[model samples]
Structures are given as structure tokens and as C-alpha cells.
Target: MQKCIFRFIRPQDWFAAINLKDAYVHVSILPHHRPFLWFAFEGRSYQYKVLPFRLSLLPRVFTKVTEAALVPTREQGIGEPPSAALGGGRPSPGFALSRPSLKVLCRPDTKLCFLKSTVNASVLLFLDEGYVKMYLKGRPITMYMPRDLVDTYCLEAKADLPPKKLKLDWVYGYRGRDCRSNLYLLPTGETVYFIASVVVLYNVDEQLQRHYTGHTDDIKCLTVHPDKITIATGQVAGTSSDGKQLAPHVRVWDSVSLNTLHILGTGFFDRALVCLSFSKSVRTNSNVCFCEKKKNRFLFSCVFMPFLSLPSQCSNESVFAADFHPTDANIIVTCGKSHLYFWSLEKGSLVKKQGLFEKQEKPKFVLCVTFSENGDAITGDSSGNILVWGKGSNRISLAIQGAHEASVFALCMLRNGTLVSGGKDRKLISWDENYQKIQAVPELYGPIRTVAEGRGETVLIGTTKNYVLQGSLDGEFIPITQGHTDELWGLTVHPLKHQFLTCGHDKHVCLWDSASHRPIWTKTLEDAAQSAGFHPSGATVAIGTQTGRWLVLDTESKDLVTVHTDGNEQLSVMRFSPDGNFLAIGSHDNYIYIYAVAENGKKYSRVGKCSGHSSFITHLDWSVDSQYLVSNSGDYEILYWIPSVCKQVVSVETTRDIEWATFTCILGFHIFGLWPDGSDGTDINAVCSSNAKKLLITGDDFGKVHLFSFPCSQSRAPCHIYGGHSSHVTNVNFLNDDSQLISTGGKDMSVMQWRVV
Candidate 1:
């Protein structure tokens, strides 16, 4: 059916009449605008006018409708509240309108900061200026800057931020007022960070004051007293002082108090005190002095009676060598250039003197003199001959001639009465009791400076050419195995087996098998190797390398098992304990390292380190029982160590310029010690045994061998000198039957066999 609907619409400020005929009419209105409607009537016309809200609309506006009836617009206002007529329109029954409100809409961009590709930033330090900027994957994060970086960042970060940006995810500030100079960054926890700074200041003057300002020279020799309260210094000429220097002075002072104790200087010509030594028995209160005479060019040793006023007497113009008897505190022996003399401290007179072989073309200058294992006198001379005089009247018992072609630099007597000698002419000789040369090996490319024998036939020879030779007693001189690339200063043979060790300028410890003539192993020491030897058992080898690194190596494996000590200025010698448990390493740094070796399944480990020597360790040896270890260094003192107590047992000063020293069992109760005497000039070497036997041996720089003997057993006695070699004698060895002796040296490079004829 056809429908008619009446609707009231508010347009601006007036009401409207609308009719719906066949279809419903849709109408819409807005604030302050006219109303709009659409109807489906065939023909219809409506008029609307703007009026005030109080005005009412007239009806019958749809009279022209054709197919539908019409309804007046005023009828639709019936449901309106009274307020509808006011300016505020309330509500209609069909729809309600609320107050108008404001709402805002926004869209934000998500761009992040970027980092510069060319400039990479590192966290040097954290400081107070600004946060440290770090870019991760083109995102920036800030870290607290270190104090040192604050000043630097202030100057560097002044430019505008780079086009590439960084994303900042975190930041932290510096704390405290003090600024650090150096910075280190570390992780605080799992994800946090921390910074550490270190400050430094330089002081140049203090370092210079400590090393340069000294009394005189390079301070070659220094000796400290038993209490360590006093220090004695020996100054050589041409050092810190003038070259024409003579009679070098000895100064004593309190080490801690720095107070001067005493000064000893000579009035007789400006003669340098070449060597000095203190007594091992602290109660003795006396020191020995060895001086070189300039006129006749001789060596003399004086007891230096400090408490007594009587002037010391010169034994003889021929006196060239002397030393205190190791066991006796008052007795001393001197070997003259032509004769040997014995002196008694208690008697204050020359006990007995013996004249050497007078048959030589000229008075044979006694090159070296020493005591044998039985307290008998032994001597070598310029004629390349070795003489031994014991209890047998005034006649010489043993003589070895033609020991070496050049002057004999060193001589060592083994426990089995075998004499080992080296000389200037690059020759090594082994001798027998009758002074017969048993084996003459000429493997050294330079002058043989030293020779040592191990337990068996192994012999160790050191040369001036920075190399060492290990050979057998069968006249087979093994070629040098190149390990130390510098001049070899010293060498020592193992007390037990065919193994021997050496040290040189290269600062390396090298182990060699004399039988194989090959280097079994080598170790690089911080300092140069001066001397080394194997322990009594041949298991551990002690090495005295430069820089004071006294080390012990396992002979079988050549492993650096232990560093006995360090911080030495120079190390000179090393020796092992007879029992093969302890090692002694000596350094030019004026200290010795005594260490114990622990074995674990063929590996040796250093378990202890000891220090005792006060200068470079020049010589070293161990007792047969291994209870005592002896060492000599630049301080011109011999030190004895007792490993059981881990302390120094005894220290003796052998006042002679000890080039080398060793211990050997000769007689039933006698152990002999041998060393070089006289400076680099004459080949006056000496040998002595604990039994007090003395001998005189002379040699020239060209390798000569001489032999002589003394009668006294308890005192340092003199012996008769005998001439043999045309040149210096380097080595001496006793025969198997003890009747003949063998000698070798430089001039002819041949080992000579001698007898007691």
C-alpha cells in the first residue's frame, strides 16, 4: 500500500515540511546549513524559508503530490521539548546529539643514528668531558669517558656530528675528581663495563746518580765482610783512573754506615795489587796480598801483619807464585822464579828453601808452583817441564818435559793422578805420574785456555776461539760442536761419566758426549755461559751463563730443569755436587747459585736456589762426599757451600788471580787444587792439595813445562824448579803406574812423556 510519512527537519534556524508518497524520503542536515531530502513522489513541490527558531512552519506544502498523500512538517514537532524552541536544541525522540569534542592524530618516523665508515673509534679511556660514543651496526651508544681522554676528546670531537649517525642505547658518567693518565677498559659484570686508569711520572736524574758517580773505575773487585757491614774494594789501573797507575789501592768501608774503615797503599813503586783474599777463619784477622814487582818483574805474597810493626820481608827476587795452605791458617808457600821457599807464621822465618834444576841454559823462571795431594811440592817452568818433590830428600821425584809448545795457561790433576794441561799453542795434553804424556790431542783451533776431566776418559778443553772440545784420553781430539757462537771462557768436566759441559760468550749451556763428540743438547740462557759441568752422577749439569743466570740441566735430556739464581752481573763457573743431587753455578755478578735437583722419572727439577759468591764465579768444585761445594769468582775469594744446611759453610781467599780451580783426590787423605797464577804476562800456574803438598812449575807464554818439589807437609813450602819444555806447558797427567808423567803444550804441539829418572 502507498504510505505517507511526515518528517520535521531543522535547517539553519527554521522548520521544514516534508512528505513521503510512494517511497520513503531520506533527509540530512548540518549545523548552520540547509536541509536536503529525496522523495519518490510523481510530482511534489515544497517551499522552505530561513527563520528564527521560535517561528513555526505552515502545513499543506505537498498539495501537488500525485500518487501519495502528504503530511504537514509542523506535526513532526509534537515530541520536541520546550527547549527545542530556544537556541539550544535538546533532542528528538528518534536521535540524540552530544557536544562536539576535539581529537588529534599523529604519525612518527623510526630513523636511527649512523656511524662514519672511515673513522673507527676505539675506547682508549673514560673521562668527564663527554660520554664515549660507540656505534654498533650504525647505532650510537655512549660510554663514560676516562679522565685522560677528556682533554683529547674536547679537541677532537669539536666538529659537527658526521653525516653517519649512531644510536645511543646507554650512557654512564665518570666519578671522583682525580684524573688518570692511562686507561684500561674491562667488563664489569655480564653486560656492564668498567674503566681503569694508570698514571706515570718519569725521573731521569735519579737513575744517572746511581750508576755513574762512583769512587774510581768500573769497580772490578768488591768484597763484603762476614757480618755484611763492611765492603772492601780493589781498584785496578787504566780503569777509572790513569793508565800509568801502579800499586792499586785497597779501600775498606762500612757498607751500611758508609764510613771509611782503612786504606792500604804501597809506597814502593806504583804497583797494582793484582789480587787479594780474606781468611776463611774469621778469627785469624789477617788478609793475604799478592803484588807484582815492576823492576825485575816478579810476583810476591806478603802476610801483611796488621797488628805487628815489623816490615814484611821479600822471600826472593825469583818468587813468582804463592798461596796460603788451605787447611793451615798460619803457613804459606812461595815459588820463586828460580827456587821455591816455605815460610812459618809462628816462627817468623823462612822454614826451608829448595833450588830447582840448575842445568837449564838460563835460570828457568818458575812459571807455576803448587802442592800435591800429599803436601809435596809440584812446579812447572818456562822449559816445559813439571817437577814434583815430596818426602824424598832434596832430589826431584817426578819430572815432565815438553808438555806444550807455547806457554801453559791452565793445569788440572784428576783424582786418578792424571794431569790435564792446556797452553797458548792450541794443544791439550794428558800426562801420567812419571810426567809422561799419555795422549796429545790437537783439536782446538786456538790456544787451549783450560782443560778438565770427567769420571771416565772424558776430557773437556776450552779455547780462546769461543768453542769447546770434548775428547777421550786415547789421543783422539774431537772436533768442536758449534753451540756457543762466541769465545769460550771456561769449561768443566762432569765428575761422573763421559759427559762434559761448557760456557762461552753466547750465553748458552751446551752438553757434550765426549765419546760421540757431538752436542747432546743445548739451552739458551739469558746471559752468556762462562763455565759448566755435570754432577757427580752425570745426571745434572750446572751452567754459569752471563747475566747471572745460574742454571742446571739434565744431562741425559739437556732440559733446563732449574734456574738456581738470577740477577747477577756475570756468571763465570758452574760445578755439580759429587752425589749428583746439588749444583753450584757461579756468576761474575759476584754471586753463586747452589741448587738441589729433584728427579722424577728421568727428569730433573730444580728444587732450591742459593746465593753466596760476591763477584763473577771464576772457579768451582765439589768434595768427594758432595757435602761441600767450592767456588771462586771475580772477588778473588773461594766459597764453600753445605747443601744440607742450604748456607755457605766456608769462604777462603786464594789471593792469587785464580783463572781456574778444581779438586782432585791424589793420596790417601789428600785432595789437590790447581789454578793459574800471575796475570796475563807469565805462564806461572800453581797447584795445591788439601794435604799441604807444594810444587813449583814454570812456563813461558810459548808453552813450557817445569817440575819441582817441596819437603814441608803442613806449611806453604818452596820447591826446586826444573826446566823441560822449550815453550809453555799446558797440561800434565800422571802415568797409570804413578812412575812416569805426561805433559803437553804449545811450541811443538806434542805431548811429552817424562819419568823420575
Candidate 2:
């Protein structure tokens, strides 16, 4: 066999290679283990099987070579060459090669998850290692893990929590202890709590500490001793020790133990007790003085001079006014209808008596009496005469005549020696030391209810018409302020501050600073404020409203704290206790409510209620000590309630109107002709009363002025009426001395000044 050799050749001519299927092919092999090919394909490997050569068409003879040629060799080796010759063997003319093989690898296992296409679906459950990972649009958002899975993925999320609850607290409460169904509480909480109910607890000690149930009806007046250990009470109308059914009697008791101490009556006389005064004297035989009177008759005086049951003397029927000597503390003085009496303090007997005004021409009756600062006395009569008496025997020092047109109601002494008087004629009159008229002012609209003197030469006047007037001592009438759109019910000046507070039907409290003549502030209440007062320090103000609501406000901040009463009746008046620890509110519900103001000033608690009044309560006043509360009711009675004992000490009926006659007249002609109409007449005047030295002043609606002095220990009347105004007298104010007065009225529509003398 001949060895085959491969060779490569370029195409010599394109036409010569076209049809030559079996033409010579050229192949080249690299230098190592060689094969010849027609093309130069680089870095490629292939495997092929050699086929046996065939000589069908070629005419040749060849030797078979078992080894492939490393390079073409023409000579044969000595012993192994050309040994065997196949019949007609020739090298294969051409060889075929295999094409290059290629293999490819791919990964198709990863996936992305998506929500199903349906409306209104929510996430339910999820599993870890699941094929699907949640995504919005081929972007991964969140992943869920099943409870049993332990996946390592961080979660970036937020959550919202639920809300909390509110809390509240309860304070103290109280129950009634008497038959009157009075309620009281002392709250210690900052916020006020609604009172759910009140129940009275039973006490085995049934004997009341203070008992005043003596009247056939309800007892009217009560007075407790200064020590708060003793109590005295009076009945309206009853039999005396001598079997006189029309006479009123009095009883004294040991308040703490409820023991009867003394019983006194108007012996054989059908008289009623109007007033009482106890002796604070430590000396033997010091008396307890009181006033008594018969119906439509004159007032008389009685003295239980000795605490023992010794014979006590009563003044004659002529006495009209009586009072215990304020300074003496032992001596008692009295005035008859037309006479006066001075009684011995220790003996329970009368010392001296005198008759001043004549009976025939003595106007109608003695109306009032009062004592001067120097122990001198003044008496007023219905004839408008004022009689002044010195300290000596029964001798008259001065006489003021024609002071008022009607009976005198009030009298007061000024800083100077002059006196002021107010009467039913609705006029105010001023008088000098000699009892001579100095100045007169007519009060228009309504009667003057009260007068107050202020510092720095100012005087304040309160009128029934619901207005307050201020003026200088030099007779300059300045209208200060007005309230209650309806009537001037009550007025009280701030005890320390130059400001004054007024309340009325307007349901508002107004404060006026006198120095600037400007209204400082005004507070409107939910109901009509009948009365208002400032705390002794003036830092807090207390107002009583008609809805039985009491409000205490911080004057500076105007923040209010309200104390609500059980009933919705009108609270007529209110007063702060002397020590400022308690507040007393009187209401038409016939109950006096006491509230204990907490020390921290955050809350108020009801202590107790004093309920003895049978009718609507109209007014109330507290003693310097808060232990005693005095109240006046529409029943024409005054009662003293002692808080410590939770009882009434003394009940006294001062006067009772003829209800039948007054009612019939009001019903019959109240709406009739102009002359008898209830409207105050054109000629009507204004009047005011004062406890200052027993002075009364009247200013007519027409501007007439009058002055009178009603002695606390003598009988006297209004002197005369002084005419001055062209129209009605609206208001009247008294200066230091009754010698100077101020008046305001209509027509002129301006305040007017007058000199009494």
C-alpha cells in the first residue's frame, strides 16, 4: 500500500472547479499528526472512521501501508515496506471529514408571583419557601411566611394602637336631721358632683339641742347666747302666764343639753314680742330686755332684770320703742306711743319715765327711736317731729318739726353732729345739731332703701327703683351706677376696696370703682341676682341668684365656682361669714344653706341647712361670728338659726299684716282708676332707713325732702315735708351730716343737690 499525503491548493480557475466532482482535492495538516484537507479551518478537532479503499473505476495496483504518514515519504524501509500488495490496490482518492459539534446549557427554574385577576379580593394566607413571591408588576413588594417557616427576611412596617378611658371621683355628702327636710354637704373635691339623694340618719338623742316650737304655728324668731350655749325663742300669738290668749311669750333653754332655763310671758296683756336683747353683764340682777305690743296699738317694754324669777315690770301702754343700752350692757330704755322710759338694769324695775309729744296733736303714733353717739337719744313720731333728749333727767334738748309728710321709717347719725331721716313720704331730710333742717332732697321713682358712707367724702344711696347714686359731702349729686333692670333690691359696698357691687332683677353683678367713676366689671348670672357681696379681702365675690344658685368668683381671674341648691326658688340674700370659712345663702324655699369653703379654695361642701321659716325668705345677715345666722321671711318674722346645734334658738314675730283686708283691697282696686292704681302716685315720694343713730330721710317723687330721728329708746314721728323738685324724686343720698343730701329724679333727668337747713 502506498501512504497517502494531504495537500491544500487554492482555486486556480473558477471555471475549471465547477463540474469536476471527482477532481483532485487538496487538504493540509499541521506538523504533528497529519491529515490533508481542502480548507484551513483553525483550532478544530474531529473524529472519523477510515473506509476500505475500492478500485472500481481506476486502473492501478497498490501496496497497503498500515501506518499513517507523518510526512510524505517516497522510499520504503528495508524490511517492512511494500510487503503485501492488494489486487489493484490504490490509495483512496479522497476522504470525508465530520462537521464540528456544539453543546448548550440553560437554567429555567426561577419564578415571580402575581395576584389573581378578580375584583374585591384581600390577602388571606401565605407560606414560606413557596414558589410565588408577591410583586406588583414583576417588582417584589412584600413576603409572607407561614408559622412553621424559618425565613430570614427583614420586615419594614407600622401599626396603630387603640384608645384609653376616663376616670372620675366622688366627694362627701350629708343627710337631714330635722323635720324641715333641710339638706347640707361638705364637698372636698375639685369638681362639683351631682347630689344623687339625701337620707336622714336617726339619732337616739331625740331632744333637740335648741327647741323653739312654741307657736300654734311655726315659731318665727330665735336668738342664741353669745357663747352659743343658750337659746331664747318667741311665739307669734299665745296666752301669757295670766291666761291672756292674745299675748306672746318667750322661753330660754340650755342649747347644748336642750334643758329649759326660763319661761316669760306678757302677763295679762294681749301683746306680742317684737324684739329681745340679752345682758352680757357679769353683775348681779342685770336684765334681759325686750319689746312687746298689742295689735293696732302701741309697743311696750319689759325687763327681766334678774335672771331669777323675781317680779319683772312692764312699761305702760304709752311706750312705743325700746332697746337695751348698747354701751351700758345692763341698762334698758323704752319709749311709749307718746312717752319714754329708762329702767334699772339690775332690779327688773323701771327707773324713770317721761312723756314728750302730746297725745291730741302727736301726728298719729311714734314710729322709731335711736340713740346718739354721746348717749343722747332721739325719737320720731307720726307728726314728723323729732325729739332729742340729753343724758340728764327727762329733758328735751332739741326739736325737729315738719321733717316728713308721713311716718318716719329710718334715722342715722352722720360723722358730723347732723342727723338723716327717711319716711313713708319718699323724701330724705338732713338736720343740724340743733335739729334744724339743713338740706332736703326728693327721691324719685321709688323709696330709698339704704344709704352707705364711703371713704374720701363719698356717700352711696340705694333706691327701691333699682339704682345706686353717689355724691360728695359738699352736695354734688353724682349718679354712680344702676343694675337689675327692674328694681334696686339690695346694695352693699366692698368692705375694703373702693369698689362697690350691686345686684338686682337684671341678673347681673356690676362693680364700680368710685375714684374713677367707672364701671370696672360686670358679671351676668343664669338667674336674677338678688344680692351680692365681696369677701372681706375683696379677692372673692359671692352672688346669690334667683335660681337658688350661689356663685363665688375669683375677682381677678373671673373664674367662677357655683354651688347649686336642691330647689329652684329664688335666693333672696347671701352673706359671707365673718371668718370667711363659710357662706350663708337664704332662699325663698324657706331654707338657709351653709357651705364650708375648703381651705385650699378648690371646692365647697354643704355643712347643713337651717330650715325654720314657714314662708319665703326675704333677707339674711350674719353676726360677726358665723355661728349665728339671722333671716327675715315674708311671714313678717325674723328667726335666728344656730348651726352648731343644728336648731333654731329664738323665733320672734315682729309684725303681721291684716292679710284679708290688704288682699281684698289689692284684688278690688289694684287695676281700677288712676287714683287708686297700685302704681305709685305722681305726688308720691321716696324714703330710706338706716341703723346709724336711728335716722330716716324722705324724698318725694316731686322732689320734696324730709328728715326725722327715731330714737331706739323713745317714741317720735316724722316732722314735715320740704318741697323742692319740679318732678318726681328718683333717688336720695345722705352726706356725712344729715345737713347735706343728694337727690335724683325724672323731668329734670338729672341729679340734684339740696341743703336741709
lDDT to native, each model: 0.39, 0.42
TM-score of predicted structure 2: 0.28
Off by over 4 Å in 1: 1-235, 238-247, 250-269, 275-287, 295-320, 326-331, 336-340, 344-346, 349-354, 358-363, 391-395, 415-417, 432-445, 449-757
**Most lDDT-accurate candidate:** 2
lDDT of 2 at 433: 45
- My TM-score estimates for the predictions, one after another, are 0.29, 0.28
Candidate 2 residues 291-396, lDDT tens each?
Answer: 5554422222323322234234554454444555546754556654555666554565345555454443554566556667777777677777777777643667
Q: How close is candidate 1 to the true structure, as a TM-score?
A: 0.29
Separately for all candidates shown, the number of backbone clashes (residues 3 or more apart, or on different chains) is: 147, 86
Query: Residues 367-433, candidate 1, lDDT per residue (tens digit)?
Result: 4454555656565656666666564334577666666675655566666766666666665666664
Worst 10 residues of 1 by lDDT: 101-110
lDDT of 2 at 589: 88
